[model samples]
Target: MNSLSRQLKQQFSILGAFVVSFWTIEILDIAIFSSYLDRFGIIPHNLIGLRGILFAPFLHGGIGHLIANTIPFLVLGWFVMLQETSDFFLVTLITMIVGGLGVWVFGAPGSVHIGASILIFGYLGFLLFRGFFQKNLPSIMLSVIVFFLYGGLIWGILPGLGPFISWQGHLFGFIGGILAARWLSSK
Candidate 1:
């Protein structure tokens, strides 16, 4: 196979493994743990809760929540990978740190925030800003496509969507993505 084909396979495989892990953990949490794992998610203003920054994205409330996150995670994540696979990891990391920290700092004291929405918003942020930062034709075109397809999601960053929605995560995740895009594109 050609180099591009090989890269695509590798990217898809990595994304597949992530999806598989999400499903496996969800199945185990529901079937074996009785949703106990969810407590590990982000809980603001508590020292122990800080660890949730690393774990929250992988935990979900239920199959319905996981199902809601799966498509956007794969699609937006793949778009980030299209430019460079390493950027995918970097963006995820930055989003988790910034988004997680945001929730930990500002989220409701007793509420638990979990799900890949953080990463999804991060990907959206990166894609939307990458074109402007990179200042290239390909990046511009990709950004436009991503905007047209997912721009409606931008509203998620605001409050009043619902109690369950972590707009803090969405907002910070998006900021992290833009930060990542600026940092990466500069280099």
Candidate 2:
């Protein structure tokens, strides 16, 4: 294979790794929790525990919940890596860590949020804000397309979605992504 093809394959390999890792973790979390559902799920009233922050992101309520999160994660993650692999990983790691922590610190106790929606919003925010700084036509156009495509994300920020959904995590994750992008661009 040519050098360009090899590079593309390498990039895709990295993306695949990330998607598989997340899916694996999610599935394993479900399997583990299936046997001890009560012990694993975030118990909002007990917010002071470490589990409130770390375990919450891993546990999904059901298979449908897992599927709902996994698809967008793979698709949006592909796009983020395509734009810049390093940036994608950095932003994702920061967002997940910070967003998760944010939820622990401020979210209602026992609230568990599992999914990539928060990360998606973070990517969107980074892409849009970065476009403004770089003033790149391509980035700007892409940002516009992303904004329109996920325009309804604004509503996701609202608190009324459901008692089970951790909108707080989603909100903080998005914010973390935006902050990461700005910091990355500045450097």
Could you say which candidate leads in lDDT? 1
The superposed Cα distance between candidate 2 and the true structure at residue 136, in angstroms, equals: 1.5
lDDT of 1: 0.94
Cα lDDT listed for each candidate: 0.94, 0.65
Off by more than 4 A, model 2: 29-58
The CA root-mean-square deviation of candidate 2, after full C-alpha superposition on the true structure, stands at 3.1
Clashes of 2: 3
Error of model 1, residue 122, in angstroms: 0.4
Error of 1 at 66 (Å): 0.7
In the order shown, the candidates' Cα RMSDs to the true structure are 0.8, 3.1
> Using alpha carbons, what is the TM-score of model 1?
0.98
Regions more than 4 Å wrong, model 1:
none
> Per-residue lDDT for 58-175 in model 2, tens only?
4555667667766666655665665667777787777767776776677775455555566766676666566676677876786677677765775776688888777777777778
Please report how far candidate 1 places residue 149 from its true position, in Å: 0.8
